[model samples]
Target: MKQAAQAREVDVLVVGAGVAGLSAATAAAWSGKSVVLIEKSDTIGGTAAIANGSIWIPNNDPAIANGFTCDLESQVRFILSECWDGFDESQKWCGVSKETFLRVDRYVKSGLRVARDLTNTRVQTFTQLDKIFKRYFFSTKDSVDSVRQALGPNHSRSDDELAKAACSSWDYHWENKFNKVPYGKHIWAAFDLRLAGKFFFSGFRKHLWHIVQNMVSIRSLSSLADQIPNLFTKFWGFGSGLILVERFRKHLDRQKVPILKRHELVAVATNGDRVTSVDVQTADRQTLTWKIRDALIIASGCFSHQLTGDGVQDSYSVKSSCVAPGNDGDAIRILKNADVQVNQNPRPVLAQTVIQLAKEKNAISHEPVFYFYGDSFFLVDRHGRRVMNEKLTYHDRAQHHVGNAEQEFLFLVCDRRFKERYWGLGIAVPFDQKHMIVGNNESTLHEEIDRELRDNDCDFRLADNFSANLRETKIAFNEFARTGDDREFGRGKNAFDVLGYMKPDRDHDAPSRSMQPLAGEELYACIYGLSTFGTHGGLVCDEDSRVLNSAGDPWNNLYAVGTCAASFLNGHYPSHGMSIGTGMVFGYLAGLHATSNTKRL
Candidate 1:
């Protein structure tokens, strides 16, 4: 338990090492300010390190570097649609007009500069970025328009909602063609492009415009070949957030930034509305205070019960989260202690429903049974019925699972093949069967079930027999095996459902034929425990990344980013990497303001 004995001084003090804090520390340091970043956990990257790490910056320089245009107006309209009925436009950067908002020279360009710094990419060619980001884009105009027609004008579902349907439907491949518009910023752009309808549609529409803008004579590659380069630049080369955050940390390391892990923010000394300094508590309970001359940025993430019991765990969830071990609500509590109106009682999302296997091969049961995207499995609840699409995006699945009445008691009904296919969390090889509860007839199932669960020592509830009290369960399995149709939950009906497919050219809408009955009339079941992604919500901040007090006054010299701040998407977890994206853009926003002669705190 090492400790910092001397009080330090930094121009910008960043708390939390997740994407938000990491980005802030880097930006402010690069902006000619002395910076110190501290993390409560022993590790630097917070929940972000273990995350998928994709970020969405709509209408970035990549769209225009190759003559691709994004509809700024359309982007604005789509973002506003996230609120469902209406949204406060004034909260959007002081209600900047669409014309003023598209000044990528300010937002997108600067944000990309921040991104380039984080990713360590010298690759600046548009074609190169397009190629790299190809997987991130998928156009959905036809699908959205078709659904829009079906719903008619009476439905009034915004393009954003329609895009959600298309993305979740998994019926189409958008190819990363985000809109030519550069408008939407907060609620819509608040998410990565894939989550919102307008971005997909804009990508769809803009791809056409981009193609024409390129002046192609006949859709010929030769026409564009003259502009395409060797296609790659120097990067940290880690695609997941784990690598990105680490790379950013490396940049901080190069800059001599003091990133103290295992040092948690204990208190803030403020004079009037300005933060004067922050006190940090180390592993051995040694308190070291750092004087903040300019500003203090709070990028500490929202609460997760994995390491600290800071945030409210959903009643239907387990305490463990997939994020870094220290995602307890440090930012929430500290701000609230300062009389800040933090968003209260936030909902927690999970990375995936995870179950720990025997840490040792021959060890007895250690944890819950996990459900994977293998072909031969389906989830059933206490009612022996499916509860959701089962194949929607992970966030949507987490949302649905959290809402289930039998949320705490889901079971993965699978054949032996499925079990063999899914060995453990993130594991492909087979695990020791000692952890599994195997049985023959209906009697053996129920009779040995409780004993096996207890022996395994996990928090899962597996029923005894397949055919005993589960008439509907048996029927659903039989039907799934026969027609490959999850008639109960409509499984495998959309692109999101085909997540198990492992090919470049996959019909995302196709079901893996793994649901068939076993050859020897064998069936099995395990308790599929629902896992949480992470927590969302905290003190709310204005568009400038300034923390707002209970009376709606900005707390001078204090800013919040990442999950430590409330989502402006009207409380909806819309897309992938949004938690990181919002944290990033706003972290960049905080850095710019913190370094400015005009302090916006």
Candidate 2:
């Protein structure tokens, strides 16, 4: 045990350089407070960098600028339909509690305001998807198929093109019964269309209305051509997440704030309820102490890495995570160690279904399978029974797996045709053979699947009535293929479901573009696990983002934002960038509130 170094005082100390931490640092700096931003890793962007970088800001600036409006009550109502269960006083909205309702309301308003602020300050910019398509048009002479083939897998597409591929419409949950305003809330990082003119033509050739309609037609046709896989771009692509981080980093650089890397929070010292100082370990394991003059904002993200701890060991276990390393429940552990009470979400993980592929014969790696590219495949339980709408959003589908106790594991059973045509486990597109259990025939596939299940160390096994159940499942799937309607789960019943099935053919014989006849030979199956990009549970906090103690009181000069604080969403993920959006919103609030008070003597 080395002795701790001398204490250095700072007006503000922000843990984690992820989106939330960056936002906090930016806001604190804007407030004219001396700030120290520290990250456990060498890189800056946390999970945001690894994701699509779209932020689901209801009533966002771009939408408002385009003459779209979503009232506060409607926004709150839409959220209630997505996440909450009970009704409020009016009995029309999700009425969890007054406090909960108010919190949700605050989140909506704050998220909108933050988007506007970021845009105005040029710290971060956003663009609507409809406008992105209208601004850029591909040549009709080349045809969508020819262009896609000409530009191979490694083809360079602008960030905006990538966004268009990922999200053609913001109508993800329009099918949900309680949604009032669904189309305008979804937004992505803005790019200069002027710079992206090469891939798609620069100027609008036809009338404004005609060009817009033509763009829509082209988008639909492009979708038919399978021009894009979900949430992916070719080569070392320039994603929106990178764009978002770069802008934030530029702002921090301009502010002259120092973002110290390789600093891991080890010990936090508290004077009663207030955090007075924190001890951080350097790369060489040297401990350095920093005294907090104003506030300590923890935005280090969730505990996807930390397997066992006070708030973690007993809660639900996450099967897999794509979150950046260093999110090892450091904040929760340190806070609990210092006698602070952390809030625990019963269902904490933001769910995403993943498959564990064999990196080596003995080593396994997780690959996210958020969407099944074609309609030819179906998912089933150990008993060979369909459990969910295979077309549901990753969060929704993964939630089913997380909460379902009877189904130990689900298998994505697809034919060779389906496998060859589109992607499975999207991030690692072109699924490796090692990632799947392949069989030449039905009997072999069944045997291999059962063998894989029996060998699973993650408490998964074949059901008692596996053989009988599988035959019935196959019969049902065939019936679904014939009718083009998944009567049991409503698989292809929504706008989102239609978007996921890249048609890629003007004249196909299949009844539904989302579904096709299964190939007779060479089938594949991969075990799906309950996965998450990050968790949303942490210390409970107020609207100001101040952490609260056991008796429900704010700890002076201490704050938690992003995944460091309990998520206001409760357990719902409304759209693409909810985590990043809410994180920045609360982080901004935390930074401003934390700096409002004068420094302690």
Candidate 1 overall Cα lDDT vs. reference? 0.52
User: lDDT tens string, model 1, 454-530?
Assistant: 66564455444334555556565656756767666665444333322221112223333334443233556654444
Model 1 segments more than 4 A misplaced: 1-7, 59-113, 116-239, 306-314, 351-371, 400-405, 424-434, 441-443, 454-466, 469-472, 499-519, 569-571, 597-601
lDDT tens digits, residue span 154-186, model 2: 646554443333333344555454454445676
Candidate 2 local lDDT, residue 491: 62
TM-score for all predictions? 0.69, 0.80
Clashes of each: 35, 6
TM-score of predicted model 2?
0.80
Can you give the lDDT of residue 586 in candidate 1?
76
Each model's lDDT comes to 0.52, 0.64
Error of 2 at 295 (Å): 1.2
Off by over 4 Å in 2: 1-7, 91-94, 97-99, 131-168, 176-178, 192-238, 307-317, 337-339, 350-355, 358-366, 403-406, 424-430, 453-459, 463-471, 499-507, 597-601
lDDT of candidate 2 at residue 292, scale 0 to 100: 85
